[model samples]
Target chain A: MIEAIGVSKRYGETVVVDGVTLRLPRGGVTAIIGPNGAGKSSLLSMIARLLPMSAGQVRVDGLDVARTPGAVLAKRLSILRQDNHLPARLTVRDLVAFGRYPHSGGRPTREDAAHVERALRYLALEGLAERFLDELSGGQRQRAFVAMVLAQDTDYVLLDEPLNSLDMQHAVAMMRLVRRAAEELGKTVVLVLHDLNFASCHADHIVAMRDGRVLMQGSPAAIMTPEAIAAIYDVEATVHEIGGRLIAAYFA
Target chain B: MTAARDPRLVLAVLGALALGSAALFMTWGVNGAWGFALPFRAAKLATMLLVAHAVAVSTVLFQTATGNRILTPAVMGFDQLYVLVQTVLVFALGASAFAGLDRRLLFAGEVAAMIAFSFLLHAALFGGARRSLHLLVLGGVVLGVLFRSLAGFLQRIIDPNEFAFLQDRFFASFNSPHHGLLAIAAAMALAASLLGWRALRRWDVLSLGREVSITLGLDHRREVTRILVMVAMLVSVSTALVGPVTFLGLLVANLAHAVMPSFRHAHLLPAAFLLAVICLAGGQAVLEHGFGFDTSLRVIIDFLGGILFIALLVRGKVR
Candidate 1:
């Protein structure tokens, strides 16, 4: 389980994430959906210890995320932010192999290689394994980055805006991959999502945020209501139940 | 990308290039007395080779740590300050009086100042907020220009003979190189390279930038601090040896990146070292023998290196 106790991120008097207390249980996809500048990314980064919180604490499993050694915490959790630009030109296979660095400490053994291969396969990036990251399309690059994170093979995977720059088809495929990672691998997956309908359709738990504070947190049925969507996004969104899933129609 | 472009193959080619340069530098033309000329030439050769290694390795490692290919230590006003130190020395004591000072004291004082300058620059610019690398580069370039103007201003006040003497010492001509400091510099550079080897192991993670490095459990702050300290030491060693060749670092480090198949420092560092050796030794040999000592080695490196720097900028690679 990931626990955040009054986590706050302040940058010189401008509070981005303000005293947000929450618990994200393990083994399910928790989609943090909010408008831009709503502190979704900030909140996710705080939980993963990517950014130092101005106050409060976060713990992954029973270990304090802030206090644990990075290598030890790395085995428990991994994070992939939206922009994964690299100065060095790296092939998909080479980039994925870096995920094993925390475990093997730069010298990957046979078992590490197997994990890398599995990650490549998981993302359906096997064909593009030899291709450099810069040469790939944005969507493919997104998948390749996710492949690297998956290759980390941690108990918890935190993704910040993982669906950015992804087209509809690729977005659906990526979400399915995230869901599969949760169900099959039993990994705890938390992600910042842009599209509310995707969260409504795919996320088991939804946490809505606006103005650096959590508006609500519950199952999709409870958090996907029309008023909840409006309060979170400041846009009139109609909620519809289709095929036993709450889908938000906000594009109109 | 190609089987023919295997890293081992590139390593062999670069190794060959280094060896070829060393051989030519050692035995280009031996008309003078064997005992006197050979050892004298060997000191210069050794100095050039050590500076080459120091510049290349320091730049590559510094770039790796900062995740910016364009920000060589020299670009960050490392060598500019060295020049400023020499200029101020000459300006204060006059060339004749400055020459009377102990060379080792002068060298030690200059190295100490450069080390102090590096730490101050890093602490001031890199603290409080995590400044972007481009901001750091901009700050460095601005400081570099400031130092150059200050040095130029000092040079203008000095006497004509003193100005010429200072120019002779500062422009990085292979002729009249500092022979006495070769052993000290070479040892310092060697110790630095050995210390840097540990940091190089985790460079792959460090190369990924701050978040990923931290995510992988690598202490990004500690590693960058270590690498920057190493850079300060290496830059001091090289500049104390042969004046500063700012563009030389960019040339060799970028070449190593372009030549290597991976970012593994194990390969990049060696490749960069060989390229640096080849550039310095070969440039020295060509100047000594091919051009009959007509021009300064620094002149050639600066001209070509400046153009290459502009090319890298135009290509949108530096940012």
Candidate 2:
């Protein structure tokens, strides 16, 4: 279980993440959806220890993230940010193989090689394994990064805007991959997402934030109401129940 | 790729070139009696190889830490700092004081100052915030200008005779090895290289970017800081020994990358060092014998290296 207590992040005069305290349970997919500048990414960064919180503490399992050694936390939890620009040339295999760095450093053992192979196959990147990351298409690169995080073999995975550059087909496929990782692998997955319908259709729990505070948190059936959607986005979103899934239509 | 076209083969060729140059450097000063000439030339050869290794390794590490190809250790005002120290010594103690001062002490003082300045600069610029590479480079430029202006001001205030002595100190010369300082420099370089070897694997991961390195459990901030300190020490040693060859590092490191396309630091570091050795040793040999050039070898290196730097920038390969 990952827990944040009174997490707050302020930049100069503005408070980006205002006193957010929440618990993300184990072995499920939790999607954080918010409008622009809603502090969704800031909150995730704090939880992952990528950003220092102005005031708060985060605990993963029994270890305090702030006090824990980086390598230790890295072994248990992994995070992939939205934008990753590497300055050097690295192939997809090289990038994914780095996932085992905490365990093997740089020298790959037979076991580490097995993990890399499995992750490459899992992401359908076997054909592009040797291809440089810069040469791959946007969606392919996105999957390659995801495969790297998956190869880390962490129990808890935090991804910020994982589907940013992905097309519809790839986005749906990526979501299914997240779902399978949570369900079959028994790993806890937390992600910040923009598309409300995608979050509603796939997430086991929905966390809606507005202006740095949690507006609502519940199952999709409870948080997908017109009143809840309007309160969170400040715009009219018609919530429709189709195929037993609550889909929010905000396009119109 | 086949073994014939393998990039490793290119690295092997460069290594051979470095070795051949070392051999040439050792024998270049051989004269009527082999006994006396060989030791004198061998000392110079050792100094050249050490300085070459120091500059090449530091520049490559600096580029990796900054995540940019165009920046070198000189940009951080390290060489300018050395100049400032020399000028200050002349101003305070007079030209005659330089003859009495221990060369090793002077070298130590200069290196210490450079390392301290670098630490202070990095702390001020990057403390508690994300640092942009552009901003860091800009800060370096500003610092370089400030140090150079200060040194120039001191130079103006000194007597004409003292000014002449200071001027001689500024231009790079291969005639003097300062054997007293060589042992200390070699020891420090060896220690830094060992630490670097321990961190080599993580360095490859580090070049991938901060996010990936952090995700892989490497302490990105601590690791970068350590590398910067090592780079500062190495740069100080090289600049103190041979004055400053600003473009030699940029030329060699880029050549290494062009020749060996591997991202692995294990290969890249050796290739870069070998490239530097070949450039420095071979250029010195040619300047002394092949061309019979009476000028300092630094002039030849700077000329070629400056042109290569411009070409690299024009090709847009330095991003």
Candidate 3:
């Protein structure tokens, strides 16, 4: 379980993430969805310990994120941020191998190699393992990054807008992979997503945030109502149950 | 795609070039004074190699920290900062007294100042959220100008004779390095390598940018700070030894990248070091023997490296 107590992020006078305490359970997919300037990314970053909190504390499985060593937290938690620009050129395999750095420290052991191989195979990147990252297409490159995060073998994985630049097909593939990781591997996945329908379809729990505070939180079934959507996004939208899944049409 | 040559093979070729140049610098144009010339050339060779290693390693590390290829410690005004510190010391203590000060003590003081300045600059410029490339370049250019202008102002106010005394230390000269400081520079360089040794793996991870590296469990701030301190020590070693060679680091590091084409610092570091040695010891040989010119090697390198810097900027390779 990940617990954030009175989390707040203030940049000078502007409050980005307000003081809010929340608990994220240990398994399945939990998606944080919000409009722009809603502080979803900032809140996720703080929970992952990637960004420092102004006046709060986060505990990941009883270990205080601020006090615990990064290497220690790394074994239990891994985060893949949006729009990573690598300064150096690396092969897909070389990049995936870096996932074991917290464990291998650049000198990969036999077990570390096994993990790398597994991740590459999982992402169907065995053929492109030797290819440079620059040579891969957008979706392929995104899969390679996800492969690296998977090889980390962390119980909790935080992704900030994993589908930022992907087309519809790739975005669906990414969501399926996230759901599979949670179901098959029993990993707790927390992601900041922009597509409300995708989140409703894939996420077991939905967190709707607005103005730096959690406006609502519950299962997708309970939170996917028209009134709840209107309250969170200030949008006039109708919710339809299509094949037992709630889909919101707000684009009109 | 054409197969890239093995990095190790490239390393071997560069190693040979560095060694061949060292030999030529040591043996060429000898006139039956092997007894006296051997030790003198040996000292010069050692000093050149130490400075080469220091500058190459520091510049590569600095580039790594800033996530850009064009900016080096020298470009960030570290060399001028050293000169400024020296000029301030001379202004406060008088030229004669400053000149009378022990070279080792002076070197130590300059290195300490460089480390402090590097830390202050990094902390002030990179405050977690403001890491734009423009701001970094602007800060570096502004600071470089500030240090140079301050040093020039001090030089103008001082006496002419004292200024002449100070002038010799301003321009880089490989012909006359105090023998005593060579050992100290080597010691410092070795200490820096040792300090930087453990961070080697972390450097590769760091090249992935701050977000990924921190998520990979690296203490990003601490590691960058440590790398900067090591960079400061190295810049001081080179600047104190040869006054200041502005673009050698940039030239050699970029060349290393061009030839090696590997992101791993394991290859890049040694490749840069050997290239620097070739440029220094080898270029010195070519200048002293081939051209028979009385000009310092620093002048020729600065001329070429300045052109390369401009070309890189014009080519839009700042990232």
lDDT of 2 by residue, B16-74 (tens): 89999988877875678888878888888888889888988998888787777877888
Model 2 clash pairs? none
Worst 10 residues of 3 chain A by lDDT: A82-91
DockQ (Cα-based) per candidate?
Answer: 0.64, 0.64, 0.73
Q: Per-residue CA lDDT of candidate 1, range A1-252, in tens?
A: 888999999999898998999999878999998889999999988888888889999988888888888989989899999885585568889889989889999889999999999999999899999887777899998898888888999999999988889988999999999999999999899999988889888899999988889989999898888888778888898888889888888888
Docking class of 1: medium
Clash count list over all predictions: 1, 0, 0
lDDT at position A234, candidate 3: 89
Scored by DockQ, the top model is: 3
Off by over 4 Å in 1: B1-4, B85-112, B128-135, B151-172
lDDT per residue as tens, model 3, B129-175: 85777677678889989999999999999888888878877654688
What ranking of all candidate models by TM-score puts the best one first? 3, 1, 2
- Please report how far candidate 3 places residue B210 from its true position, in Å: 1.4
Tell me how far the alpha carbon of residue A217 in candidate 2 is from the true structure, in angstroms, after superposition.
1.3
Q: Output the TM-score of candidate 3.
A: 0.96
Off by over 4 Å in 2: B1-8, B26-37, B89-106, B128-132, B159-165, B175-180, B294-297, B307-319
- Give each model's whole-structure lDDT: 0.85, 0.84, 0.89
Q: Clash pairs of candidate 1? A: A70-B217
Docking class of 3: medium
Candidate 2 vs candidate 3: the TM-score winner is 3
